[model samples]
Each structure stands twice: as C-alpha cells, then as structure tokens.
Target: MGLLFILLLGVAIHWASAAKLGVVQTEGGQVKGKNVKVSLLFRSVDVFKGVPFADVPGMWEKPKPHPGWDGVMRADTYRDRCLQVTLLQKKTRGSEDCLYLNIFVPQGRKLSTNLPVMVYLYGGAFLLGASNDMSFLGVSLYDGKEMADRGGVIVVTVNYRVGPLGFLSSGDARLPGNYALWDQHAAISWVRRNIAGFGGNPDNITLFGQSAGAASVSFQMLSPHSKGLFRRAISQGGVALSPWALQKNPMALTKKIAMKVGCWRMNEDVMIKCLKMSDPVKLTMAGKIDVLLILGKGTVMDLIEFSPVIDGDFIPDEPSKLFHNAAEFDFMAGVNSMDGHIFAGVDVPSINSKTANTTVKSVRGLLAGLTKEKGGAAVESAFSVYSSNWGSHPDPAVIKKTVADIETDFLFLVPTQIALQLHANNASGARTFSYLFSMKTRIPGFPSWVQAEHAEELQYLFGKPFSMPLIYFPRHRDLSKYMIAYWTNFARTGDPSIGESSVPAVWPAFTENRRVYLDINHKISKTSVSSDLRSYYVSYWTETYSLLPSTRQTGVLRAGDLSPPRGRPESSARET
Candidate 1:
C-alpha cells in the first residue's frame, strides 16, 4: 500500500508539471510557452494583444484619457498595422485601437535569471509601422534557445500611433498633443509592468530604434517621463536634436487639421463629438490630405508647430537644449554614408529672383526665431559661406547635392554628433560611442551610383536583407555577425566595444580630438571620409544663430518649385 501511494504521487506531480508548461493560444495562433513550476507566475509566450494606448475622443485633435488593456491578451499573432494612405493598392485593416506590443522569449525559461531586455521602436517616418511587420519579427534576430544557452535576453517590439492621429498638434489645452509619444510611454510602462512574466529583466532594458524610430529613442532620452524607463539607447539614423526634426506646437497644426476635417468651426466639445461619430476611414483619408505639404517638414517643424510637444508632463524642453545643458543617459547614435544621395533628385541651378527673395526671407525668419538675440550678421555670414561653397561646385547637380547633403547633416547627423559630444562631456561615468555606416551593399536596382544609402544598415543589423532585392556577395553573413554582435554587446553592456566576441574589426571610442568613426566597408577601417564637409558644417553652425522660441514662417521657396521654366520662359500658355 505504501509503494502504490508513492508511485501515484510521482505520476500526479509529473502530469502537473507538463500541464503547467503547455502552449497558450493567441489571437493569431498558438505558441508554446511555459508556466513557472515552483512559482505561480505564468510565463506565457503571447501575453499582450491589440491594446489601445490613447482615446481619440475627436477625429481632428489629440487624444485624451489614455486607455489600458482590460484583460490578459493573447498576443500570438501580430495585430493589424495602422491605417495608411497608400498610393499603391495594398491590403490594409487596423483599428485606432492598434497601439499594441509583442514580447518574444525562449519556449521554456525561468524568470529567476534577469535577462537583458530590448525594446524596439519601429520606423516609418513616425507615420506608418507596426510590431507585427515581418521585418521586426525578432525570433530570427536573437535565436531564443541559442541566446538562453549563452546568455538570455528578452525582445519586445511596440507599436505607437502614427501620422495625423499621432503628430497633428492643435497647440490647445483641450488637446494634449503628441499622442503618439504618449502611446510610446504607455508601451514602456507596460513593458516595465509585464515583461518580467516572460523572463525579461525590466530593470535592464535597452531601447533601440531605426530611422524615425531612432529619432523617437532620442526623444525618449530628452523626455523627463521616460527617465529610468530605459538604461541604454541606440539610434540608427534619426537623432532628436536635428534642426529639421519635429518640434511640439500642437495648437496651430491641430486647428488646421480640424478645419481640414470640417470640425474647426465647432467648439472643442462639439468637434470631439462630431469626430467620434464620423467613420474612422474617412478621418484617416482626410488626415492624409496634407502629406505633400508636410513631406519636407520634419520634427524640426514640431519645434515651432507640432511634433513632440514640450509639455511639462512628458517633454520639458527641446532635446538639443536639454542635451546641451546636461546628459542624463548614455547613447549610441550614427548615420549612413550616403544618407543624402538615396533621396536626392536631379539638381537645379540658382533660384530665380522671385524664388531667391522668398528663400532669403524664409531663411531669415527661421534664423531670427531660432536665435532670439540679434545675430543677423552671423546668419548672413553663414549663408554667404554656404552660397560660396555651393557656387564653387562646377556641376549644378553637384551643387544641389551639396545643399541636400547639408540639409541632411543639419537635420540628422549634426544633432547626433551634438548629443554624443554632450553625453561624453557631461554624463557621470557613462560613455558615448559613435560610428558612420559606409558599407555599400550590392543589391539589384540599388542605384549603383548611390553608395550606402539611407536606412541601408537595417539589413546588416537585422541579420536578414529582405529589402535588398538580391544578395550578390558572400560576405553578408560576416557583416551580419559583426553588426549583430556589436549591437547585442551594446545591449548587454552600455559599451559597444566591451569585447571583440565575433566581430571582425576593432571598433574604437569616439573622442573630441580623435573623432574616430567605424567605416564599415569591405575592409572596415576607422577613417573620416568627409572631414572637409564636416568641418565646414561645424564652423557655420557654431558661428551663427541665437536660441529662442520657434514661430510659424511660411512661403519658403522649396526645391520642388524650380521646375524648368514653363514653355522655355518665353512661350505663351494655351487657355484651358
């Protein structure tokens, strides 16, 4: 009788263990996950589902009363991506309730081990992206079992509101603008609260993003609300302090959007009610009507109008001003070699009298607003230098390219360099490392002329070149290993160059004097490709401008306006 009782008890225990470690069904499908054998916590594979982060009471304005998940969500499949205004026909289905996140971990892992956590923010010009995109699927990025065997880490990808819904600012108290930024905060909070259930260490989170996502990471660093949420950050292309990036001025832009959507005439309460009653698809379409107008306008515009707000609650001040004052955290920021060339078009000659005058006035206004103190002479000197440098170029195309390059550097690279310099100078013990991705890939339809274009490093970092049409070379795996190791190592320790595990080259530290950059090419070396250009930009920016509040200044002459003079500038047009 005693022997029989012992056998029965052992069998019951084994069955209970197996049942505890069974699979959990999610909205998309079933994923095998585990439940703690000793502890009562359930480490399920799919824990989060499509959860709304904010409530858009009205269609034309910012969100209100952020929303939270009501129950344990089954996050087996990716939620539908946000609604996009597609020029090309593509399947699209998602709700405004699409602020969602996904967590991936080893099939069966214990929570006792505090694994490093990587929270990914996707990139689509802060307008389009989702956690469910195949490109963002992290299982292949970090092989769970392999990582666990070596050293465990958790990967979390989150989706935030985008486009008009997230960025359109009303600059009104009724509309707390930058709802998308709010969504990101909510997602981070969720990770802090629930990532532990998946064997992730919330305390050691590494925030990383590419392109617009990278810019978002920089924004988080500046945000007081995001303090302590992440220990480390990596920005691929987008840096927060760029002159051309978005600034938060919600009221004006939100009012414009409201007017465009036919709700501007109504009171706030009435507008909100009308927007809520309208069809979501109609609102989405109406929102996209201003894409062309807002194309060149980036986060820098937000500095004056609407992007990420400087609300006392979320963001306190401009990231540039903030970083310049003091460094609160560590960062890894960089830009691609040919970032400007990818988006470049055929160049044009000097602007005509009308265009030139408009351009001058616009430039003057921007400089005046940025530099609240009188610095007109300095601004003119800077412009004269730019004009002379541009004029010296023999080829009109080359001159245009240089202008575009300046714009790109001003809006992206310079800000990144500033942030790195600030962090290196101010941070207590934390270090700042910088790199320039110059490795050009040989992919079909990759415009052989444009080498190492914008967002090119994404393939190498992700260890998969899906966007690349074809892989002609065999060194892809080598590059992938090198990049992944460097990135993962950074995530492990705040330093990216802690050790040379599997990477081929030795990445050096970025110092004020040395100014070393990891030149990623066939033979990755530390060198400066455009020292002259870099020097010119640094000098011009430093010598010019005053820091002041940004304001609305329109009628700026853009490159797009300079189409070849109609009918050779002398022919009369036919009446319609």
Candidate 2:
C-alpha cells in the first residue's frame, strides 16, 4: 500500500510539470515548444524555435504570411538560416526558403499581466547572420532564452533575406531593391497579428537591432508601410543617414553581378529570369568577389556593397525627408565607443603624422572612390576640416585617433546624432533617448583597450555565456541585467529607466538644446553630448545640406556651393 501511494504521487508530479510546459494555440495552429532551463534564476521557459513567419514562394520576391499547419507543429529546434557567407568567410548550411522566427515565452507569469513583445533583428552588414545559428554570435551574443526568462517579456528573433538575392535592382521595375526590408515588414506584421496567442501584448511591441539591422529599424521608421506595427524602436550603431545604409547606384552593382554570373547578355526580363534560375551559391560567390575587389582598392566602398535602395514604394524619399513623417513613438538610439573599428580594417596600419601629405593623400584617395564627380568638392572640404583638427602634423597616435574619430563620425556617430535630433525635433510628446555604450569588454584576442566594439552590448543584453571569468568581469553580468531591464521596460512602457530592474542611474530624455546622452559604463551617468564633435560633424551633415537628390532645386545646395565655412556659411561634409 505504501509503494502504490508513492508511485501515484510521482505520476501526479510528472503530469503537473507537463501541464506547466505544454502546448500553446497560435493563430495558425497549435505548437508544442521544448522546456528549456534558462540559467539559474529562471529555471524552465517554453521556447518555440523555427516558427514560420512568412512563406517564400521564390527568390527575389516579397514574402507573404505563412500558411500555417493544421495539426500541432513541433517547434523544438531552429530551422535553416538564410543563405549567406559566414564570419569565417566560408559558406554555411542555409536555404532561400528561410523566413522563420523564434518565440520565447517566460514561464510562471501571471495571467492578468500580458508580457510585452521585443523583436530582435541580427546584423551582418545585410550579408550574413541567422536567428538560431550558434556558429554566428549567440554563444557570446543574442541568447533569447535568458532574455525572455529574466526580463519577463516575450523575445523574438527573426531571419530575413540578405545579399544579392535580397537587394538586386535593375533601375526599372523588372527587379526592384528592398525585398529584404519587405521581409522584415512581413515578419513584424505576423508578430502583430499572431503574438497575442503566445501570451504577448502585440500592441506593445518594440523593434531593436544592431548594425545593418539597426539601419533597417531606422528605415522602417521612415517607411509608410511599417507605421503602427511596433510602438517603439531602438537602433544600435547604425542609422539611415549612415552612408552604407543606402545604396548609391544599385543598378551598377547589379550589372556587375550579372556580368560575373554570365547573365549580362540577356534582356532585362530574361536576365532576371536567368538570375532566378541560377545557383544561389554562385550568386553569393559573385557578390563576395566583387566586394573583395572594392575593399582591396582601399576605398570608401569597403563599408557596404549591397543594401536597401530608395525604392519608390518602400523607401519613397530621401531618409532625411522621410524622418520628418515618421510615426510618433518612443526612440532609443546609440553607438559604441570603438564603433570605428568596424570600418577600420583588421590590419589597420598606424598613420604616421610625420607624413602629413601622405596622410592627406591617402584619405583623399579613400573618399574619392565613393562619391560622384560633383562630390569631389565635398571630399576636399572634408579633408581640410580633418587636417585642421589634427593640426597639420602631430603624433602618430594623434593621427590614428583622428582617423578613427572621422570614421566613427562619418559612419555611425554623426548620423545617429542627427537621427536623434530629428526625432526629438518632430515630436508629438513621444520622448527620445540616446546612449553611448562605453563598457570595456574582454572578448578573446582583442586588446584590453577595446571599449565595446560594434554590437558588444548585444552579448550582455541577451545573456550570452561568459567568455572571460565571471570573477574578473562581474560588473558585465550586472550590466547585462541592467540592459535587459532598460530594453524590456521600454517595451512595456515608453521610458526605459521606468522598468522592473534597479538601474545604476536615472536616464534622462534626449533634448536638442541640452544635448544630454546617458553614458553606460560600469557606473551609468548622464553626460553632455560632445559639443565640439557634434558642432563640427553633426552640424555639417544636418544643418548645412543633404547629399540626397532634392525635389526642390533652389533649396538643395549644389556642388559649387561647398565653400569654406569660416568666411562663408557651411562648407564641409563627411564620407561613406
């Protein structure tokens, strides 16, 4: 009788555990996720991996809502990643039919309070990345399990198209660009319509991304199609104003790819058809070859090869003009301290200030490769400003630092500041926040001086396992909690600091007048924006004139108008 009683108790406990980690009914059908043990604090969380967000009928076409299954779908493991070259410069296992998303719901949440949704878009310069592939960056960046469990929010990771298959344009309507952005839009729409069933508040969704993904967030804010899908946004280390975010001459690059793939001789329609039929591997290889050629030339083209174009439907106008008409919602945008390291090649040679003329010449050569004929004057003016800032001939370290500064401002900082300013200026009580991630990380093989390289904050925010000893980097673990708090809190409410966790400092809203940004280090603090840097670079980019094609001939500054700023109005500009 005692043995039978003990057996019955054990069976009851097993059934109770099963009920806690059981199936959920989504809009399409029922899904059974795996019971995952996420870290120490939050033991068991149900993670639905590789859930199809959209249906891919073919390559180079817009994605549609997924035709979900009839019966229960087992979502235990991640699906295939979208095809792209890996960080190691080798091809990995992926497919063109890859428009899936991962949904993670925290366990033990009360039924009354529905959790907010946070969608993550990974970044690889629009060339490579995956939602579930640990070979990419998840081991030390973007762990969804920890984010969902600890933050008490539904975290989603999405996979979208990239490379030539995603951004090919033919100057006409035969093959338009921005198919990748369209994929993102579809994914967001899916989340909005179906996330409620997964214990998420679809109305209170936040879109957050880094690098190329960050640029996409900025673009979505500007585009009319994505309005009202998500309530808040966070762009890290990239923005629409960044030179690499928008492709200058998409057709020219498309032609180069076609020529390499032996489809150049065909008519526009035939060429596109041939491209569709061609091997995905060949297309990816061709793109990589051309990109290497562009990078090897030591030109500004090193930053990007293929990216979102100004398609009339999706990205109707110049990014600056579109920023004025963006949806009124809370925004948080920022960059890392060492973001320039992304643009500066791995083997960046120290620029010796002793060779002032050589330094100027090299800089000119790099800028000249990326601009149009009319843009020469802009490049020359930019050179003059940099030379003045560096004081003709200074120390080698000074030259190196100045170069990194210019790269940072041109690629990330200036653009990010301008975006924040625009969002703040055109406000309908929707607050704007800016931050600078300056925490020093100890990623293996990198120098100790490395202060948060691009996307380093992702590791802490998503709870990647530690690369270094926790004893040595205890503050980073603490910081991870703080960042997740800020992000998930912002998703729940508009303000990040008004969330669940205890933050180290009070984060203030960004105002154009005060120009205050939260500096997130070991100890967070609100500090003054860089007056000299902002005045020099941001003013030049935002206040002077736009580089985009203008609708009004008189309002747009011509190439001849780029004169010296001291005696005249505005003269200098930066590069890609």
Q: Largest lDDT belongs to which candidate? A: 2
Top TM-score: which candidate number? Answer: 2
Error of model 2, residue 21, in angstroms: 5.0
**Cα lDDT for residue 431, candidate 2:** 81
Q: Which stretches of candidate 2 lie over 4 Å from their true place?
A: 1-21, 39-43, 88-92, 109-113, 134-140, 289-292, 295-300, 346-348, 351-380, 387-393, 444-450, 465-472, 526-533, 543-576
Q: lDDT per residue, candidate 2, 209-256, as tens digits?
A: 998999998988888887778888899999887777888678778878
| Runs of candidate 1 exceeding 4 Å displacement | 1-74, 87-93, 106-112, 134-152, 266-278, 289-306, 324-328, 346-397, 400-404, 441-448, 465-472, 511-515, 526-533, 545-576
Error of 2 at 493 (Å): 0.9
Alpha-carbon shift of residue 261 in model 1 (angstroms): 1.9
lDDT of each: 0.53, 0.70
Question: Could you estimate the TM-score for every candidate?
Answer: 0.70, 0.85
lDDT of 1: 0.53
